[model samples]
Target: MPEYPTALGASSRDSITLLGKDLATDVMGEVGFGELAFWLATQRRPTPGETRVFEAVLAALADHGFTPTAIVTRLTYLSAPDSVQGALAAGLLGGGSRFLGVTEDCGRFLHEVLVEREPPAGDDGWDELALEVVTAERAAGRFIPGLGHHVHKDGDPRTPRLFQIAREEGLVGPHLSLFAAIGRVHPRVLGKTLPLNGAGVCGAALADLGLPLELLRGFALLARTAGLIGQLAEELRHPVGNDIFLSVDLNNRSVPPSAQGGPHG
Candidate 1:
């Protein structure tokens, strides 16, 4: 069984081992929390420089306004106090797929495209092989992954930045180049240039960074959870809020209640 380096030791309450480093801190943000977070995941305790990178990432990904997931997180907090974790969890579920799930698929695609090449095929061959693989996969009842996004018809801006960072870190290798080759081949659908989205680029970058496939989503969850908390906190601050707006009956249908529910007279 292969172990996940990114997920060596993660506990719900405190501590996680990143890159052979042990990080111990309370759940609440405290002094040197950022340092602790980096140490936990990357081992060897983060240098001031490394800690700076981690902080930048944390801040950049912390929150986006009124995204459905963000909105849901804030709304959850308005009605129920002490559910910050729960609200964050809900948002995390939506995001993990795009970050980790998509990354895994993109990595797979990148690897396949590389394997399918013979004798260092040129750009044309890379595209040709990718299209062939995609068509064959679709024919085999598998959808081509990391090719589309719900929000952006043209492209995902975040994708390039992540790739650029990974490249600067010397992490992008054959795996990423393979994915880039494929990404460039995608002709615009709906008259839109569908560039590699967050999932695709992150997927390739993580693979090149030597992260395990199973641990991709977990890392992403860890990162984005920070943002979710911020949204929850912001929503809680505003007083004018109709928090409990559950339209249970708006599209509700009554079902037979049995063991779970006592008789309501």
Candidate 2:
């Protein structure tokens, strides 16, 4: 027989263990989902402050009202009402560069920048470093991750709130310090101010929490899972999927193939 080792969860005939604790007696009702999630990822319990910041990140990413992911989820549910899992999976599959994936992208990007240098001494140093980073990225023709938002051109409410929460918790580590500096200084290089979007800020906060850079997107997805469920529930009550499908289906006009290659061509 072969043995597989894991510190996560194990099951026996009569009992179950999670993170080395009895799942039913120790984990259930004793740990909140957010804390349990944090524990599951890092295999160590988080402080109360860490839990608050982490849960805040989860809340920040949860739902954004009629996003493509929500739309796809509702549409998938409409198409296959028999398979709720399929609907959820459809939405989760949409977590990519333009959407929830920014959480991971920003975290990894900030981590990479931090790995190359020491922590800045203060906001002034961070701003100077951010200026250098923005200038280099501009020269390279690369967009700074977590810098802009499509909807909240003025500002992302979640961004500042998350920053405040992290600050209050004394959890503003180098990643967040750098991200905030970027928010303040990027306009000098980019020639315009852009709101530091919520997803990007969540990334920074998670990075500051020392969460795995690779699993940053996973956290975003986890948050959005609740949102997707809400979408599906609202879809049942309000039922917009059909109207959405019809709006596109009825409005689209058939045109001849263009000189440039097209999907039909």
Candidate 3:
């Protein structure tokens, strides 16, 4: 028999047993989620605040009505009653890319305002900045990331609440003030309100928290997992999850073969 490396081998066995117990108990308190994830997978702990960052990020991304992702959750529940996890996984597969980089972008925007010490005079200054940014981005042929929303013609309901929370929690500082500036600016520019949507607020919050840009999307996913789970549970109680989304597919997909004269099946 070949000799096993007792030193490292013993440590590996210890890690496995510890992780197994931790998993069974859901004992995430002592070790942060980021550290726990890393330790279980690679026997290394996450640095610091990685877990808190993970938590805030997850909470922020938890739900936003029935986007494609939420729709998939409902559909999977309708099709497979017992497979809640499966439904959630399916929904997550469709989670939008828009949510991923939100925190980073918000942070950058706030950072710009902070570094520049440029405080807008009420809403008008805000509008001018928005116009300048929009015009520049459009002229440059780049898509504007967050401005107007589809469902929220005037403003997003989610953004203001988040800002309020940030202010109450004393988390709002430089970035938050900038977000306030953005909110005030919305009504002046497009002659319509542009309440800070979830993505934009999340951006500011993440920046304030000092989390890196790369983690925002992952945070969104973790946050949304809660929504997926809730949606799955809700879907279980009634047949309400039964709405055919073929139309959604139709709208999102490529134009159908030059509108070929008739409804060819």
Best by lDDT: 2
Candidate 1 lDDT over 80-192, as tens digits, reads: 76776777766776774444356567766666666555524566765666566655665687655677777766777776776666556655566666666657654531233
lDDT of 3 by residue, 110-229 (tens): 666567657566555665665665455556775434455667766777677666666556666556555666566545445555546667677777666655555545556767788888
Model 1 C-alpha lDDT versus the unseen true structure: 0.59
TM-score, predicted candidate 2 vs. hidden true structure: 0.97
Top model by TM-score, which number? 2
Report every candidate's CA lDDT.
0.59, 0.96, 0.61
State how far residue 38 of model 1 sits from its true place (Å). 6.9
Candidate 2 lDDT over 1-265, as tens digits, reads 9999999999999999999999999999999999999999999999999999999999999999999999999999999999999999999999999999999999999999999799989889999999999999999999989989999999999999999999999999999999999999998888899999999999999999999998999999999999999999999899999999999999999988788787666
Model 2 poorest 10 in a row by lDDT:
256-265
* Model 1 regions lying over 4 Å from their true place: 1-64, 95-100, 108-125, 188-193, 239-265
How far off is residue 219 in model 3, in Å? 0.8
**Candidate 3: segments with Cα more than 4 A from true spot:** 1-60, 80-85, 98-135, 138-144, 186-191, 242-265
